[model samples]
Target: MAICKILFFLLALCIWCGKCDVFYKQVGDEVSMKCGVDSNSNIEWKFNGVLILTIDGKSGNRRKGLSHIVLKASASGDILKVPRLETRDSGNYFCRQSGKQHIVHVVSVFVKPGPVLLQSSDAELHCDITGDPNKEVQWLRPNGQTYNEKNQVIHLKSVTSNEAGQWTCLVKDDLKLSVTLTVVGLQTTAVNASKGDDIELPCSLPQSVFQRVVGGTWKAGHLPKVSFPTLTNTPSKILHWNGKDLSKVNFTTGQLSTNFDVTLKNVQSTDEGTFVCTVEFDGEVRLSVETTLRVVDKHSGKTKQHLGCTLFIRTLSFILYGLKLWIWIAVGASSVFLIGLIIVIGVVIQRNKRMKKRVRKLRSMRQPLTDKDYCQCINSSYNNCYSVIEVLQHLFF
Candidate 1:
C-alpha cells in the first residue's frame, strides 16, 4: 500500500506538471486500464478532474461522474473500462482515493479509415491501444491468423475481396477491438521504371466486382489525355482523347479482357506523376484506378562527370607509360652509338701508330749502303780487267 501510494504520488506529480502517461488508440476501440491499487481499495475515477465515479468498497455503490459520458468500473474499483471509444473520449483519466491520487492516464484517439475504404487500392490498419506504452499488442487477421508484430500498422497492397473483412486488435488479456474493412472502386498500382525504359500501368477489376466497362479515358496528373473505343474481345490501340497525338503511349487489354493496361514507351522524366484510368459502368458510374510512376535517370550529370574524369585519368596514364618506354629506348640507343664511336676511334689511333713505326724501320733499312764498303768491291774488279787487257796487247806485239 505504501509503495502504491508513492507510485501514485509520482504519477500524479507528473500529471500535475503537464507530463503524463499517454495511450494511442483508434476510435471505436475498447479501452481497459488498471488503477495500480488494491482491487478492494475504495477509489474514485475522474475524467479531466471531473468525478465520473466513486466506488464504495464496503457498500459496492456506483455513482455517475459526468452526466454526458458513461464509464464502467470493475466491482473492486481497481479497473476502468470504456465499451466504445470515440474521439470525444480522448482526455486525462485520474484514479483518486481520500485526498490521494494513484494514477494518471492520457488517451489519444484517432480514426484510421474515413467511413469506407476503396477497393483495389492501398490501405493501412493501425493497432493503437491505451495502456503501458511499452506493452505489446497483436493483430488478428480476418483469416484468424495472428500477425507476428505488435503495435504495428498492417499495409494492405492492392486491396481485394480477400482483404475486405473484420480485423481484431488484441491487447493481451486487457482489450480487444474489431474493425471491419470494406473495399469498393477501382484498382491502383505503383510503377517504377528507369528513364527511356518501357513500363505498364495496370487497371483491372475482378469480373465478380465489375461486370462490363462501357468506356474509359486515361488521365495524366488529372488531365484527360488518352482514350480507347469501348473495349471488345479484341484489344486495340489507344488514341489521343482530345485528338492531340500521343506517340509515346499505347493501351492494350489483358488476356481476360478485364485488364486495361497502359504502356508508356520510352518513359521520360516528365512522365513521372500519377496516372488515373477511369472506367464507366452501365449506369454511368465511373471508377478510377490510379498508377504512380517514378522515373529514375541513371546517367545523371554528376555520374557523367565522374565517369569522364575516370576516363581522362586512364588515358593520361596510358600515354605517359608509352612516352616513358620510348624515352628509355632512345637513351639506350644513344648510349650504344656513343660506345661504338669511341671503340672505332681507339682502333684507328692504334693502327696509325703501328704504320708510322713500320715506315721508320723501312727508312732505316734503305739508308744508302755504307760508301766505303761499296767502293772497295768495285776497285778490285776494275784492276783485274786492266791487267788482263795489258797482257793480251804484249802477246800480240
Candidate 2:
C-alpha cells in the first residue's frame, strides 16, 4: 500500500509539469518545445492531445506498455521535431505523460507565389511586391497562365496597332495579400484632311501629352502607305497632293505670314482640291487646323487688252490732230513769206525806172547848150568879119 501511494504522487507531479509549459513558432523554421521534468521521472508524449509515447515497466515486458515506440527524450522530457514542413504542416502539437493533459503548441506556415521576371521584344518589366515579409510576384496572361519569358518587356518589338492592349502583374503573400499591375499600350491619334478646292489637313497631338512620346505613325485615305516624318528644329509645315500622288508639301518659305499657308504655283483648275498639313512633335501628333481653297479665273488678260485698245485709239487721234494743226501753221507762214517777197521786188523795179528817166533827161539837156554856144561863138567870130562883110554887102545890096 505504501509503494502504491508513492507511484500516485509521482504521476500527479508529472501531469502538473507537462501542463505548465507551452510555446509557438513560425513555418519554414525549426520547432522546439519543452515539457520540463526531471530525467529520473517517468513520462509520456502526446501529439494533438493523442497519447503516442510513454515510459513504463513490467520488468523486461516493456514492449507491452508503449515500449515498441522510440521516444528520444531530452534530459527534461522536452519534445523537439522539425515537422517535415508543408503548407498544411501547421497546427497544435502537444506532449503528455500519465493522466496529465498538456495544451498543444501551435505555429502557422504560409506559402505564396515567387518573384516573376517578364521579358518583351524591346524592353524588360520587373515585377515585385512589398509586405511584412516580401511577397511573391507573378506575371499572368489573360487566361490565368504564366507569361512567356520573352514577352516580359514593357516595350514590344515592332509595335503595331493590333499589339495595343492592357497587361497585368499579380503579387501575393502568405497572408493572401494581392496587388495588381496595369500596363497601358501606346496609341496613335487620328489625322484629318480638310475639304475644299485646296484643303490643308492638320495632324497634331495634345501639347501636354505629346512631349512624353518618342514617335508616332501617320496614314491617309485609300493611299499607299507612308510613315510619319520626324520633326526637327522646324516642324513639318504642310502636306499636299499633286494630281498624281501625295507629297510632303511645304510653304514657299520656311515661315508663313498667315496661320499656315501653302502657295500653289500656276494653279490649274485641277489644283482646286483638299490639302492637309500635319504637325508632329516628339513622336506624337499635336495640333491640327483645316483650311479650304477655292480657285477662280482672273480677267487680267482681257482687262489689259481693253486698256491697250483704248490707249491706241487715243494716241492715234492725238497724232492726227497734231498733224492737222502743223499743216495749217505751215500754210499761213508760206502765204506771209510770199506776200513780203512780192512787195520787195515791186519797190526795186520802180526805183530802177526812175533812175533811167533821170539819166535820159540829163543827156537831152546838153544838146541845147551846144546850140547856144555855137551861136555865141559864131556871132563873136563873125562880128569882126561882119563889119567888113556887112559893109561890103550893104554896098552891094
Instruction: List model 1 lDDT by residue over 153-269, tens digit each.
Output: 666665676776788877545546677777666666687666787888878764433234456766785335534323432235332222235476765433334566767788888
**What does the lDDT read for residue 80 in candidate 1?**
75
Tens-digit per-residue lDDT, 1-397, candidate 2: 4433433444355456654332233334445555455544555555433444554422211221232122432222344353433323333334443343332222332111111111111223433221111223445544466656522133334233333233454432332222232222222222222222233334432222212222222333322443223322323533232222235333333322122333333444444444444443333324334334444444557645665675465554453544754466677899999999999999999998987877666556533434434333265586644444544454434
Predict model 2's lDDT versus the native: 0.38
| Clashing residue pairs found in predicted model 1 | 51-65, 52-65, 119-184
In order, candidate lDDTs are 0.60, 0.38
Kindly report which residue stretches of model 1 are placed more than 4 angstroms away from their true locations once superposed: 1-45, 48-111, 114-116, 130-134, 185-397
Model 1, global lDDT: 0.60
